[model samples]
Target chain A: MAESMTETEQRPSGVPYPGTPEGRRGTGDPGFAPHDGQEAPELLERSRALVDPAMRAAVESLPASMRRIARYHFGWEHVDGSPAAGHAGKAIRPALVLAAAAALGGPAARAAAVPAAAAVELVHNFTLLHDDVMDRDPTRRHRPTAWTVFGDADAILAGDAIQALALRLLAEDPHPAAAPAAARLADCVMELCAGQHTDTDLEHRAPEEVTLDEVLAMAEAKTGALLGCACALGALYAGAGPEEVAALDGFGRQAGLAFQLIDDVIGIWGEPLRTGKPAGADLAARKKSLPVVAALVSGTPAAAELAALYGKPYITGDSEGIARTALAVERAGGRDWAQTEAADRMARAMQELARAIPDPEAAGGLLALAEFVTRRSS
Target chain B: MAESMTETEQRPSGVPYPGTPEGRRGTGDPGFAPHDGQEAPELLERSRALVDPAMRAAVESLPASMRRIARYHFGWEHVDGSPAAGHAGKAIRPALVLAAAAALGGPAARAAAVPAAAAVELVHNFTLLHDDVMDRDPTRRHRPTAWTVFGDADAILAGDAIQALALRLLAEDPHPAAAPAAARLADCVMELCAGQHTDTDLEHRAPEEVTLDEVLAMAEAKTGALLGCACALGALYAGAGPEEVAALDGFGRQAGLAFQLIDDVIGIWGEPLRTGKPAGADLAARKKSLPVVAALVSGTPAAAELAALYGKPYITGDSEGIARTALAVERAGGRDWAQTEAADRMARAMQELARAIPDPEAAGGLLALAEFVTRRSS
Candidate 1:
């Protein structure tokens, strides 16, 4: 492990360590360590190669209608069953699975974790399909949402099928870790649903009636649980002991929170061309995102103004009002607060990763991925 | 096994055997064997005692918001979280689990199957919650549907949580059968979803476009798969070999088909007070139920008239049109076909049960339960 420490020292000089104070500033750039921008993509590509085939096979095993909907959702086909060169998701969770497995048990562990990686990806897509329907979002990945193309019932059933497929993939695996991994994944899904329930419930409440703590908890449950599950599953597949697995889980959880915090910030200020959504879409929908909740509770004059804007019954096509609310959130210190909180979470994630792997070289891809998640404009 | 066979011979004479020709008529009575009506109630009561608490515990394990929705859906509480005597569904799936275990491995097996029983019940309720929302039905079990009471998002999330809980219960079980049982249950859910997808898809097409074969296949997937899973899980927990487990699955599948066939008949003709919905509810919605599909393909004058009736845009609260359509369906031989098909399925179920248990007495309760399911007015 000590021999690998030199790898961290060799990182490019301009990129601040994610834990450093300079990295805590609202710098737009991720400034990833060393050759991460180049190296991480190759790693992710390799992980995707391992995971995508397995995922395709799983989806193929579904019944015909469900298979069609899943294929369409994954950008593998069109609504009319014609082949399409559509863009799939970034496969971030699968990359994490493989990286975590490699960190724990090296090359063989990475190989063994492929099924787990596929399972996690399937779960991620399942959530996306269902979430898109529940949120009534019209677009994802610069294309029409599955519910819009395939119809809501088909989309919902397809999501259900994919969830079952995830568990089936793990359960059918010959690995000794499969059963436990399935259990963990199921638990994570329950937490995800609970978080979603709270999220939509909060939408019905007055802005001031919601608390930052509640929103934070919801984010952890909704976003962090699955990421933690992916890491834990990878570690489990690597035959790591419970303590190491748990540490990796903690690492992923904090990293997930950091990712959500940054994502929330982007939801408010992201450029539409990059994010594939309208600018300030979250504000337009009056979504009680982390930053929005934080701003509402800030006790500043801007916060009061933001609350008053939220108090008005939302009218359709009120883009200007939504834009003003975004400005109010920023003026109330929500943007800065989210940035600082994300950096702190990244630091905590790094601490947990160090405790788990104890080798910075093995942890390189994980650190890069964490930076990538937080840094992306979309 | 031989001693048990004698118990079957001692059944009273007035109650017809489920396999008898007289039981195949549209008498609207179960014609249960011996003291089945009375004895079955006792068995169901005992099974419920074992399954309900476990189900409650599973629901309670969910987060507070989800727990509230689940409890309310199960009729254990009101919308305000106050206690209420609500009617949960007939714990038929759980009872099948316990009964199958008992038939296969006797008393100890029955006790060992408790977790499997609970898991199946949870899955059943999960499907019910989701199906209710998808169907947009306003009432279930003589009360407003969960979606009406808790909102669509909450109901959907609660349903999702229950499904996860079901898998969790099995995965966490110490029994050797737990992993396989969980896998089987997940597969059953996938099939159920596929069937639901097909059902909704068929609804979008002209009634004549749907074939009897397709309707039967959907019923088998939607209803039979879960029942089969329940029996297979029970047998698995009893440590039965694959052959016996498969036989029990066949038995349950056939019985489930019979139940569905009868249910389709009831949807057309059953009393509103007993069924807890308006009379001819399926007809009113222009639902492509099994009998209706069968009639559409019958090619009689009545079939054409029924098609014309279905072609019209359905108006809400048009009970007279629904009643006329129901009569047309009967005139086209749908009623007769369903009755014969149900009897055939019941016979097939009995044959499979005999192959598995090898003792008539061991099958008595199973036969009775099958009869009860097919005979119920509700």
Candidate 2:
């Protein structure tokens, strides 16, 4: 594994080079070999251990009802306020925050970035709670979504409270970097809102009228902005210069785009059990996901068929139609295009990381996180 | 008018002592006389001029679609993107922010408080936008509410964006007080969410099951917290000590409570044209407003009748039922109680203002604004 980390040219081109079943399913890129997956999971566990207490403390600061809703949303409590061993998220963003801090300013800097890591995690969950309500998605992380359990108003309010708490945490931090960190996070939130607005607006338009560039911009705002902010915040807290912070932000943005591309592919073809969603859920809803959009604009015969299918009203029980649409999207080369784009983005991400931290040892954990995000079937 | 400003004891106990037609209808408290309304309007105009440019600049920083929605919400543009002459709001919160700053420090301090003033105004409008969506209110400031025109998702997203922008403005300010200002603003937002959560929860339960203390706490959270934060932020910006800031916060809190009490009275009894809402609209929705809660506990025959009426489902378009309920609330002394409470709060507000700023001349604008808020028919 150490040799593979040093030998960047021999690393997997697109997929995670770790011995998970899904990661091992990579296209046969030359000289690529799957290493044991122990390192990534251990790092993730460490990050969670480091960040969870602060995150929990932030959620606990919310008023009673909101605190209950937030705790439940974080999988820390049951609906009845009893402790529950539910699945929290993978803590990927917080991991990136800590890793970036450590990369820039070593261990003490990483510790100083703990509040920022928790803040980013809070912002991420805030988006999830609101997104679930806005999209009317009933489930998340294999559990009923907060909106479904707490009712829409409470869910939305919880999201709002969490977002405020994120900023409050940063603003109250004694670190000099706190002010700029808060400003950056707030800017990212506005971008997320703009992206979500554009996404919903696109859904109301004809498939043929939407441009790929618009979709990509929306994806960057909706997904990449927060990830970039997470990394930038960590660097800022580490007392890194603006250029270093910007470099980390760029790295995270490319990785985020790659993550979204792979996620779009998985949405079409991933096993529902692994993804923890209904089979072909995106296609069933005729969602304008990246792969589907690529297909609709491909100008192939299958592209026309896919567009026609998307134009029709998507009925809830029409699994057959959904499967057919997914097939048409793949036939138009949307799946392959997304896969290639993901690989390209991954390469770009590595380039940015190298520019920011020339030492391969410092970049190892961030690279592993990027691979983990892209390689996850879920 | 100057003599009357010094003759505080002879001021009207409940209503505003400004020379408006509605103000002239005040109950005959001995030796009370309406002063010319010119001072409050002039002060409001000055405050708006001071705060609007900063507010506009903050909104302009948002991305395009969100910027458009926020501008529209602020009455700066028509839905078609043309400039409009729509009334934004009374700008009361921003006025309080500046007044508090000037009262603590000199006029130069008011200029220094511009960002804080803008921040508080943004927070105020953020709450209004969300409240309209949550209550499904169709009209605000004599025009269609943002949610009605822009759709619920956009209105909500716009509100979220504006809120983030408020904190961003504070964080970006070069003032030493920016960090604490941002923290205070964010904390107030959480309280607002908690209050809103309790409010919605109350709506789902029988009125008899809710206590006046609970309702008052909700009101303080929903209304008084932000007002207090605004004043505290202003005082903080003016470099006031903690005790002075706390006193200003107390002043704003009592004024805010008085504001809510008068708003409840106006909701049920004010003229529709003046209030810009249907007469007895609160009764029409059977909202658990403070006056209604007071009347429910009054133990009068009218209170019993009101309780019986409230026990039934509130049918939409039941204007007759709403009017009768309003009459019952008044007959049970709810109106009288709210009026007395408002007067008591105003007295407390004055006391706190005196503690914060011993000179009555410095306190004149805040006093006038408080009287205006509680006294205005709208």
Question: Of the candidates shown, which would achieve the greatest TM-score relative to the real structure?
Answer: 2
lDDT of 1 by residue, B135-157 (tens): 89888887799988887777778
Give one digit per residue, the lDDT tens place, for model 2 in B1-378.
123222322233443323232333332422123233325777789899989988988998999999999989888898999999865888888888888888788788899999999999998888888888887889877778998999988988898899899999998998988888899889999999999999888888897888888888998899888888888988998899999899889888888888888778777775456566666778878888988999998889998999999998778888788878988998888877886777777778867877887755566677677777766644
Q: Compared with the real two-chain complex, what DockQ does model 2 have?
A: 0.76
* CAPRI quality level assigned to candidate 2 from its DockQ score: medium
Question: Clashing residue pairs in candidate 1, if any?
Answer: none
| Ten contiguous residues with the weakest lDDT in model 1 chain B | B4-13
Deviation (Å) of A229 in candidate 1: 1.3
Whole-model alpha-carbon lDDT for candidate 2? 0.81
Interface RMSD of 2: 0.7
Kindly report which residue stretches of model 2 are placed more than 4 angstroms away from their true locations once superposed.
Answer: A1-38, A314-320, B1-38, B313-323
DockQ of 1: 0.63
For model 1, how does the per-residue alpha-carbon lDDT over A63-137 read when each residue is reduced to its tens digit? 887898888889999878999886487888899998888877888989998988998898888888888988898
Best by DockQ: 2
